[model samples]
Target: MELLETMLRSISAFTLMMLIARILGKSTIAQMTYHDFVAVITLGAITANLAFNNTISIRILLTSLLTFTGIAYLLMFFSMKNRKLRSWFSGKPTVLIQEGKIMESNMRKLKITLDTLNQELRGKNIFNIQEVQYAVLELNGSISVLPKPESQPVTRKDLHLKNQSEPAFPIELIMDGDIIDANLQQNDITREWLHSQIKKKGLSIENVNYAVISSNGNLYFDEYKDQIEHPVDKE
Candidate 1:
């Protein structure tokens, strides 16, 4: 049947895509470089054709996909080994802000306007340009910011506090009322402990929208409903 054929094609295409992605490692779409961008777009078009185009046979589609994957892997390997090739493939990070002053030349070269720069800065919680000590425009179109020493958050080390341990990244234990068993196991937490925490809050696991184990080994949870009380401003 035509419906079955379509379903088979869709499944095959998706499986192939996933296999290719796994082989390529975990450089997400956001982290992709100029070379990767081109390859990904071309691969997507090929995938769509594989899924829908009757003219393109599965054998040809797979061949094309494998060819592109091989090329991508080759480029990735070379880029990692060669600095010049890496720079050419990924481009270089440009200095957008230095010592609280905007570099107009670099901005113009990158085609970034003052307003756009300000917006990106604001996204990093900087309202004013003067607060930034250094800001580099990464090749992947992200800004790496360094705030002035005074503007930066005061750390425990800065206060001469000792015996402070490095924090672990928070691990998601539950999402949309479903337990993330792998994450729980990786973090060395048991389901019994999670259920106990939920019961202590006078809530059920099903009522929880999301839950995470914080760096300090605390259970942070968000219920399906908003429960915070906000004071209204009279002014």
Candidate 2:
């Protein structure tokens, strides 16, 4: 029947889309460059037509999808290998502000207005343009701001304090009462050690909703029930 055929086509298209997404990798989902945006729109169109346009043969729809995907893959690979191709595909970062001075010509070239620039600066917690040493317009439509040295926050070095080594990233050891065995093994931590730590806190693994080893090498556990007298953000 036509209804059964439609259902089958929809399911097939959905499956193919999932496979394609995995093949394209995370960068496509995270950062949308000009090429990535165009590819996504095109892919979406193809997917929708394949799912609902029963007038078109399934073979033709699939061929279009696969051929487009193959071409995109080739372009991405070459773009990585060549600087010119990469610049053409991703576009170059433009300097909007240099040495505490606004580059009006560059801003005009990008069609960015003064109001838009101020709004972007405000988003980065910069209320005054005088505080900015450099501001760059990235390919992804984000403005990267560098504060003037005098306006920047003071660091430990400024106080002539002893420098400390950077701490390791936090590692999750348990989630929803389940132990992450791989994380434990990778970190060279034994099950017995984790159980002992939990026992010391007068709690068990089941009592923990989430647990992680902090950057400072401290074990932190969050229980399912948080005994807060008054939740400020309670809706």
Candidate 3:
């Protein structure tokens, strides 16, 4: 009887926690801001007690979980509507570098060392700090880097090439041998047309592992079997 009671309590706690997580949305799981971190730790503690502490009534544990979730939801809703509240909750971005110069004072205030700054810059694929014109520390603890104009990648405009306009985003046409009907309808691409494109490459829908309409309106296909003369990275 005791074992059955423990099993029921565990299942009940797990179900409630899953429901709470779904209600919180992706931001709660994806980005770990200071408040989000605190809330997650608190929720885990409550869940652990609710699952194993048979002495505590299930109703009281559930009420606590629901109340906390309601408060978090209200806070998120209000933060979206008000800029000041959003800033207060998530914190503001800090300018750490400007005009190829490090803001030493700001770094000191944030308790960030020179080594930490360099590490963040390297994560942005910037090995030389001299190449950076601006770097801002975001609320999510990521460093946004702007390379110096001379160090930035050259665009077609720099080469005086003719400008061509295309779709701003790529569309997936097929995945795992299945067609994306909604994408096909939205892009005005008929299934027959896509099949013909595949046939041109001497392939069929089943042969394609993935297919996409690129931003430049080019149809690209990847087959399950790849023919490579030499694989450079094969170990």
The numbered model that scores best in lDDT is 2
Clashing residue pairs in all predictions, respectively, total: 0, 0, 0
Best-first order by TM-score: 1, 2, 3
TM-score of each predicted structure versus truth: 0.66, 0.64, 0.63
Worst window of 10 by summed lDDT in candidate 3: 161-170
Candidate 3, residues 171-218: lDDT per residue as tens digits?
Answer: 789866678798799989899999999999999888898899875568
Please list the C-alpha lDDT of all candidates, in the order they appear.
0.82, 0.83, 0.81
lDDT score of residue 33 within candidate 2: 77
TM-score result, candidate 3: 0.63
Model 1 accuracy (lDDT, Cα): 0.82
- Where model 2 places Cα greater than 4 Å from the true spot, the runs are 1-3, 161-235
Runs in model 1 deviating more than 4 A are 28-30, 161-235
Is candidate 1 or 2 superior in lDDT?
2
lDDT of 2 by residue, 1-235 (tens): 8888889989998999889888887777776778878888888899999988988988999999998888777777777666568779988788899878899999999999999999999999999999987898988889988787567677866578455333344678886577879889998999999999899998878888888997546789998778898868732
Error of 1 at 92 (Å): 0.7
Better of 2 and 3 by TM-score: 2
RMSD for all candidates, in order, please.
15.1, 13.5, 12.9
